[model samples]
Target: MKITNVEFVISAVRPDQYPVDALPEFALAGRSNVGKSSLINRMINRKGLARTSAQPGKTQQLNYYRVNDQVYLVDFPGYGYAKVSKVQRQQFGQMIETFLNDREPLRMVLLIIDIRHEPSKDDILMYDWLKHYEIPVCVVTTKADKIPRSKWDKHVKMIKTSLGFHPADRHVLFSSETGLGRDELWALINTTIEEAKAEAAEAHEAEEAEETAEVSLEK
Candidate 1:
């Protein structure tokens, strides 16, 4: 994908506020301060399109970033922030759950996790939840630059083991600082988009054929 137009679409808290264009959407999920913003910035080749904050729990809604008008990167509010109010956390949970469960255009979730440490309980739970719902997910272990290159495999293994990582889902080791995994991630996203389009076309053709058969029977 060439580096081209990018737009900050909207910060949506409810389904009604979501974009109506029906572009394929990829949700970014992780704990607060887990480098979701930085990953987005690196992926888009933008210095600061997605705002990064030192403060935890700063993002409270679904932030939509339209890339080349081909897809939307939906940024979910970071979970497991202790400082955030319990009620607020519940609200965030409900918001995310509703979107994930009902959103038709959502393609896959890029679940970000810091590669320097073991996957947290929250991380494990989130992964499990996504799997339970049969939602497509790509676990993105971010901040790979912080870890030494020689021990990358060791850390990745630990994270995978701790999460009981599913074989079918993707696990990408990413470094926002070094641009590691950027091309690979983009390739995965593009492939998914194309697959979705193909599936939709097939479904449309099937429906048209069924309609034609019904019309012939009536005639």
Candidate 2:
């Protein structure tokens, strides 16, 4: 799919109101101020496509962006904000859990983390929660422009080991400023959508077979 067009659609808080189209969705997730919005803007080659700010916790809702009129790029609120009250944080946690568990249309999550620092506690928890839910994820290390090229491997390995990522999961280095890892991320997104669709089709076929067997037994 050619990414000829991209536009912001809405910021939704509830799953009942999410877009009902059959288009595949890739959601961007990360801690507060991890440059998640900036990365989305860079990938789509549009400035301000996703509003960016130095302030953490700016994106409070699930922001949806349609690309080429075929796929969606969802931006989720950031986690691990120190300033947010405990009750608000708990509410946010529940909101995210509901979304991840219920949004079957979501194909994969592009989990963004800063490359300069070690994975925080919230990061680890997020990783584990996704794995538990069986939602496919690709961890993207943002702000690569700040790190030296020679030290990239060392940092990547550190993040990988800390998160206990499996052999199949992918980890990519990204930079919103210099446009690094853009193509790689897009390719992963496309593959993820295809894999999810294939699995769904297989499940549908199996259900049909089971229904046919029941019909034969009735006759």
Q: Give TM-scores for every candidate, taking all chains together and pairing residue i with residue i.
A: 0.98, 0.92
In model 1, pairs of residues that clash are none
**TM-score of model 2 vs. true structure:** 0.92
Determine which window of 10 residues in candidate 2 has minimal summed lDDT: 1-10
The reply for model 1, stretches above 4 Å from the true place, is: none
Lowest lDDT block of 10, candidate 1: 1-10
For 69-92, candidate 1 gives per-residue lDDT tens digits of: 899998999998999999999999
lDDT of each: 0.95, 0.88
Error of 2 at 76 (Å): 1.1
Off by over 4 Å in 2: 209-219
Model 2, span 163-190: residue lDDT tens: 9988888888999999899989988888
